[model samples]
Target: MNGQKLLIVEDDLGLQRQLRWAYDGYDVVGAHDRASAIDAVRAEEPAVVTLDLGLPPDPDGTSEGFATLAQILQLKPDTKVIVASGHGARESALNAIGAGAWDFYAKPIDIDALGLIVSRAFHVHALEAENRRLATPATTAFAGLITAAPEMLKVTRMIERVAAADVSVMLLGASGTGKEVLARGLHEASGRKGAFVAINCAAIPETLLESELFGHEKGAFTGAVKTIEGKIEQADGGTLFLDEIGDVPLSLQVKLLRFLQERVIERIGGRRAIAIDTRIVCATHRDIDAMVAAQSFREDLYYRLAEIVVRIPGLAERPGDAALLARHFLHRHAKAMGRPVTGLSADALAVIDGWGWAGNVRELENRMKRAVIMADGKLVTAADLDLESGGAPEPINLKAVREIADRKAIRHALARAEGNISNTAKLLGISRPTLYDLLKSYDLHA
Candidate 1:
């Protein structure tokens, strides 16, 4: 046995025996009725269940089977329930999915096709379980940042080390690469009592950017009705996150450089210089070196902010994070929106893993939120994400589709098993020799 329990629920004794014979690697348990299925669940806590939606009492209908499905889910929401029904297959499939069943199969079951569904359910369940385990705070390298990729974790560690020095730190990364989040993490680790204030230089108009950074006195201008504290003053005794620092106009760069040099600011229309104790943490997607060489940004200011520069990796640069974050976002948005999305479909996960998320985590979050709201079934499919591949349309040949799926599954299994043939075969519900044969046929290496 592979140490994974599978509960087979069916009233037909012959079919029950057939199922047990089919799944030799699993610890198969039989349940002939709804009551017995519930009892079996309580006793075994199986990871996957193959349920027939035509149990006794309504063996000719789907009522009893649906009841069992409901009870099984209520008892163990995480259980992967693949429900089968011969009556009204389409309607039953839709109803079963709405009731939170992992998958549905029409009766006259093709054991081969059903086996594929069961194997995939197990794979998805395992992935979700691992994601939940890794999502905990204890497993993360930093608070509020969720990542399982080594490169991203390395960036977190670098931030943790740089937080204590209290020097100006500049973060360099592509847009939406979580520069502001890391800036806040640095502030939290610095143990600052004051508030962490953030200002996006690119979002603000140049005319008002100075007043926004360094406050103006009351009646400083025609529209200045009341005295206001600037972001720098608001972040006193804490960290000030300056996003898109490269967008600061050349005219204002002089004043910013002066403040960094003097550790004091002269608010607009006010001569009273204010000495503020603030740590500056700035970020920019632009190349500051290019800006300096182009004479667009002040060299002095660059040196001040770049005292402890850190480069953040893009989403594609961090392997496995796209799928991890996709799952995280799906659950978060589903709960917030009260959607019935239980998890990502195998197709959805594969698309996410293979996608090049140019918009980074922001793009992934937006996609998941949209997918959760738009998904009709219990599981979010790749179609819901609206991120279809930019390449050619899917091949029409059935052989081609099978080949593609097989290659992807093999690659994913190898990754999860860390290139161990034994574990890979177990994950794929096959023997080592079978895995070796497929790998050779597909030209895949473990």
Candidate 2:
């Protein structure tokens, strides 16, 4: 387990030392004044903080301390703050709690009792943090796929079932629907001991396509100074993913078909045939059937490559998946950029669910990355997501409106509970019965 951090905000040096020594069990950090305290809170982001109610400019009053507490919470509302007051005990304690402190302690310093309270505060904080992390929508299951839509779930299940079989698999989906990710997952599940190699047929030049798949001997071409293995040979004992396989030139299709049927390849300059034991997984956004009818793509190769076909649904077809993936991307990008983003706002989520994600998961990820960098507030809003800023507000249909409402309620409940259903219902001012009704209606559950 990682050591918990404890921030003590106190001006008294001698008392700071005593408190610091007392909390030696923790990774204790100190701040002597309100300014340093705020800075420390921003920098260290401690899970628990101890604040002294009597501070500098108004050392005899609780004004500075109260202001500090408010700022700390504004910066990180999840931080557990325990206020210390040497003044009127009842009044100070009540006031501190009112200002959003986790707990309050009367001072004349009972070290043991204070230690117990601090420990309890840490425990509560840890539990709340853990609950939030687990309840986060992004971490939920999709068989390594980050989607919440039933259509996508069905696709994922199909992929999972097919991965165990050693058949040539073809993934049919629109661009940016994570075809390669699914392909990699199939490779991993197949228990293949070699590398998973991928090549985009459309991205490579036709003249060099054969050399790329079947390699070339030294001096075979002008740049061919040394013999290099192609994608097929490199994936000898694993899976080879051919992305945009529909784009392969008709000339190379025969060679690819030969390799598939014979399990062997001949280098461009070398006459000897080299045998390979590689599984083929192919993906294409294009309609290969049409291409074959037009005599553009080889029908024979198409038949060999598509032994078991899996169709991935577009983002718009997957209900609530856009928002789910958006939050996931936000968390990832925020941490990578070292930004302190808690979550998306209600308006942001509503916009996410309502919008038609034409570009799918990849588009959502890019938008979230931009939003995380540009957002000036702790929580991202629809404006930050670029969904509400420039575009004219589109009229919503009743079904769309219901989806928005359902998503909002579920997300709000999860947030309030930090993902605990009972607590979330209580926060929503409803009984667990009403919560269950809503969850069922929305097709959502804890």
Candidate 3:
């Protein structure tokens, strides 16, 4: 057994026995009616279910099948129920999907084709379960950010820890390293009532940057026709994310420092001192310390904003994250675009693992989007991602080859085990101590 439960809900005894025999690896259990299916669900709690829309007492109709689907989902919402029906196949598929079935198969069962769907359903279910595990309360503390790498998880935990405290946080990382995403995650974790507002200092001109951050009164400038709240005011009782804070001009840094010190702001061409309550969270790709030394950025302002400095690792530094993020992006885009792209090809996974993601998660996401649009097959290939599929060259060095093989095997085991050390060790046929030694020696993390 693969140690994964699979529920086969078919009314025909012969078909149920055939299905049970076909799936050799899974712990296959059968049910011929709604009551037995519900009982099996309660007992087995299978991750994936091959549900038939022709249960006993209503074998010719889908009423009992749909009811069983609804009850199964209500009991275990994460269960992947792949409904099968021959009656009005097309319409049944659509209705089953609308009724919360994970996927649908037409009866006249081509076991091979249905097996592929069942496997894909299991893969998707595992991916979703891993995502939920990654976003647990002790980890992410927010949605939209998905990562299983320990390095990134550490960063999220730190953000979650500091969210409730009223302090300035400065995220230092390279461009496209998801600094803004972390900032937003922090805001959400903070439980602030006001909106989370953000501004990219590097994207705005220095002339308009001040007005953008501090707001402007009517006729404050040539184009200022009405009074408006700035990002800080809009973020009152919440968090303000200033992306690329090193890009803030030296002149404006003085005014920003005043706001940090006094918790007050003066809008452009306005005299009233507006008291504001907002948490400051800023990020920058530039070396603010070097800028301070060069007199381009204020040293005082740097101190004010650097109350809690977090250094986020680049994508390359986080092992397995590139492939994980690629899978996440592929699923997101494929579903939104209504594409049938199931997963990434083996060569695509190789490229994702080997490539140094210089543009980080943003580049991975863009590539997945293009691949989803351009892919001709169910699996997204390296070519679909516009990436080189040429496998890494063979090594003449025996030691190098062994190390490479070990790394690849360890990564594969970790992924298969979903980052469970004991399971990974078991998969690799190694003792926990040996696996730990290998992980430390290879600088690998799960």
- TM-score per candidate, chains pooled: 0.60, 0.61, 0.61
For candidate 1, the TM-score is 0.60
Candidate 3 per-residue lDDT, tens place, 152-201, comes to: 87788898899988889999998888998899988888888888999999
lDDT of 2 at 173: 92
For all candidates in order, the CA lDDT equals 0.85, 0.83, 0.85
lDDT of 2 by residue, 190-257 (tens): 88899999999889999988898989899997989999899999999999999999988888889999
Model 3: lDDT of residue 248: 90
lDDT of 3 at 130: 69
Q: Model 2 — which ten-residue stretch has the worst lDDT?
A: 389-398
